[model samples]
Target chain A: MSDAETTIPRPSLGRLFWVFLVMGATSLGGGVVAYLRTGLVVRQRWLDDVTFVELLSISQTLPGLNATNMSILVGDRLRGGMGALVATLGMCLPGASLMIAAGFLYGAGGDGPWSKAFLHGIAAGAVGLILVVLVQLGAKTLKTFADYVFVVVTAVAVAFFKVPVPYALIAAGIVAIWWHRPRDKDVR
Target chain B: MKQLWDLAGVFAYLSLLTIGGGMAAFPEMKELTVDTYHWVTFPELLHFYSLGQLAPGPNMMMVASIGVTVAHIPGALVALVAFFLPTGLLTFFVGRLWTHLATWRWRPAIQTGLGSVAVGLVLAGAIIMGRGAITQVFFGVIALAVFLLLWRTKINPAYPIVASGLIGMALHYFNIA
Candidate 1:
């Protein structure tokens, strides 16, 4: 059958490997920042703003690995189930293999000068990249005054308040859900 | 194996909490697996956390690593399935519903509200990231400058990441923290 004919078959393992590799290679600093990088397909090519924004939204909202969500979105767009499977696996494998290797290498000794230096540059550079993500994403979503306030408040709450992660998440989630829940337009 | 099943249960639980993805869930995972369960020690968990960080596919990768460490291949399988299946089903269903519901005016309001929530979640994520990465003032400054540069530069993600690594090396050579 031609490639288009298949709707949701299991993806070929080899193709999945490449997809995994691409995601793996790009996510250098780790998961915290990699989504911004892997988002290039939407940012640089193929997808448009509204569509890309929507994809990102779905990816972020979903509970699975963000990278996997991204990959599945990309994969389903390209080929179908096989593609998604490939993408998810592709996105995941690098970290898995790398971790295993690192596990083997764990406690090998102290950090070498180069490793330390490399990590330092990464640590610094990652901040810049993450900052960029925050701004760009913010611009897309934060049009109103309320949004602006939310961002400011949340940043302070976490960075300074040092509220534990789960509580912060729950608290913010409650606020947003309640804030957005359908209200009587006339009442407002 | 019993170990695999246990990993599955943990991953399943963790997946439900990933409202904003891995970073959103990191602290929770760190607490449950690292502190509460003591399945992995803090420092050891940190290493796997690093692997989860640099791993290519998804931040949830720590599940597989965690599983593997806990119980070999089956452990990995349990963790993977536990983490993935529930979330995938839920997301796909939610996506369908979200699209169907997009016609509502209140959708925009809801989105706006969620946007705020995302900010809060990410803010929390950044704090977690910061506590780990920022050991001293020099590193802290680097993070700040880098955040600004990303906003202004429109540079490819790779460039910044690579530059950071190189920058890390430079700091080491110069004896800068």
Candidate 2:
């Protein structure tokens, strides 16, 4: 890793921000991960696939949006605290501005019947998108029958019983972790 | 004044619930913003969320929309900062420590365990969003078509999603929906 780091020229903070900003502005739809890969690995040659996947795993496990988390991690890796700051800012800026503008338009009576119909249709479509994401995530994460059980139990508790997320996350997380606890025999 | 504080506190708390992805936090987000604080109606929340999909960056940038609706620019800033800061710091520090924990015996267990739970959270969120989004058979057909198209192809999602909105407009034009 150190060898690879030494070989690739580290990007200045401005360039770092620019790279992430372009990705932020271009990653339409929801698959920001793919955009990050193309920008970092294919375009910039900043990180190889292995490192990208490693950072991505950490991003996934943490409690934040993957795009911003990746920005932070990759930024910190390249240029320390300042890099993380700039990268995250760049990644979020375009979207934040657009959504804020959307809020204003919405406040100014943008929700006419026609717009409402459009929003309703998009809302339904977004459900389909989220379902696709859910299916893909399940395929990658779930393996054993017990894993599927955890998924089902957690979903039911939250959706049907109206359990608060914190409580549900903790309860399910603890039990799931215990079930997968390290064993001596498995250490090999 | 109080609303700014409320927005900060709500978004900050909501940010931590986005374990696997932004969608994982959707249900709780709907609860606080709509049911609890009355920041937006349920349908409005759905609209902002759906619009967020077309936005360029993170999927949950709709938080800023909620913030804007509540208190304009300041509200948006506070919500954005609060939403990103705590978890951002956590990721920054934990990401550094992650390399050291690479050899930790329980690492794989934690990863595997959390992966399942994360999927569950996302599933829960999907169910809740579906309840609001799929109000009619026409909408259901749209959703199914989008799902199948995206699932089966490499085409960009923006095309189909945009088409869905246009289909919606057409339905409205004809008074079909």
Candidate 3:
């Protein structure tokens, strides 16, 4: 929709795959979005800022992981179905291979005391990382008092009551959507 | 063969539950993988998850780890395809249809509604993970320190997390924790 989409030379699907593969390998520390913006917008000029943000919004609203979804959407926009497949594969392959290796290593020696201590400590730290993510997401998403209520209800249903996630997701999602349903007096 | 199918089914199901992020499905992932399937223990799940955070791509690639643990290369391949394919298809279709729905009035409601709920899910996940992860004094301190550092600084997360592992090793070596 932006001028760049029209002006930028369309890259070949192989090129698309290679670019995304580079991104997948280098985007450390879980900030794939930032890396995406730099690669697609700043460097490749494949998409301008506005278009990049628009695609990112779609990625967030959808049910897939942000990184993979962004790759699919961007790749689809660039070169169609094959592009999407290549991009998503490129984005995922590096991490998937690393994790599989981690799995094999853990299986081999994960039960030793040293490994136990190391894993335990990393798990604790990962908890902190998750908390940071939660706060950032909450700050971005929770805008109203009622929204806060929905969050608490949903959290309680899952964490305390052990309600199944799908049930909680559906029930809370329906209620929250209806609560935010269009009001005649409301102006966007 | 049964293990492969189970791995596929479990991860495919878990994949859909990741609304806001993979962490949103953590409790359920734990419930099924650790408690139900007995594919991995709680600590092992936690370990895989922690290591996953260090991985460069999507945060939930740990599903591959679980697959490898449960079966092997076939399990790993099956898990990756299963975890990704369903949601990947959904995303592709919905993404194509996104612009056509922009003018619809309920779009904002759907976004806002799902937004808060997604946050809640992440909070619940953090709590569940914390319960298992922060069981000791040193571990708790590590969590708190990492939280504060991340909140205040722009440092890459991998450093603190790797440091946390090293600190644990050191503490164990010194018999301090």
- Which candidate should be chosen as best, given lDDT against the real structure? 2
**lDDT winner, 1 or 3:** 3
The DockQ scores of all candidates, in the order shown, are 0.44, 0.89, 0.85
Q: Hey, what RMSD does candidate 1 come out at? A: 5.3
Question: What does the lDDT come to for candidate 3?
Answer: 0.91
lDDT by residue for model 3 (B1-177), tens: 999999989989988988889888898999999999999998889999999999998888899999999888888899999999988999898989998998889999999999888888888999999999988888899999999999899898999999999998998999987
Write the residue-wise lDDT of candidate 1 on B2-88 in tens digits.
655667777788787665555556566766787766777654554455445445546556677677667666666677778887886
**lDDT of the candidates, in the order given:** 0.61, 0.93, 0.91
Give the per-residue lDDT of model 2 (tens digit) for A62-103. 999999999999999999899999999999999999999999
Q: Indicate which candidate wins on DockQ.
A: 2
RMSD to true structure for each model, in Å: 5.3, 1.2, 1.5
Interface RMSD of each: 3.8, 0.7, 0.8
**Candidate 2: DockQ?**
0.89
Per-residue lDDT over A29-143 for candidate 3, one digit per residue giving the tens place of the 0 to 100 score: 8878889999999999999898898888888877879999999999988988898999999999999999999999999999999998898888999999998988888888888
lDDT, candidate 2, B72-139, per-residue tens:
99999999999999999999999999999999988888898999999999999999999998988999
What pairs collide in candidate 2? none
Cα lDDT of model 1 by residue, A117-166, tens digit? 56555645554554555566677667767667766776666657756655
Question: Model 2, residue A164: what's the lDDT?
Answer: 94
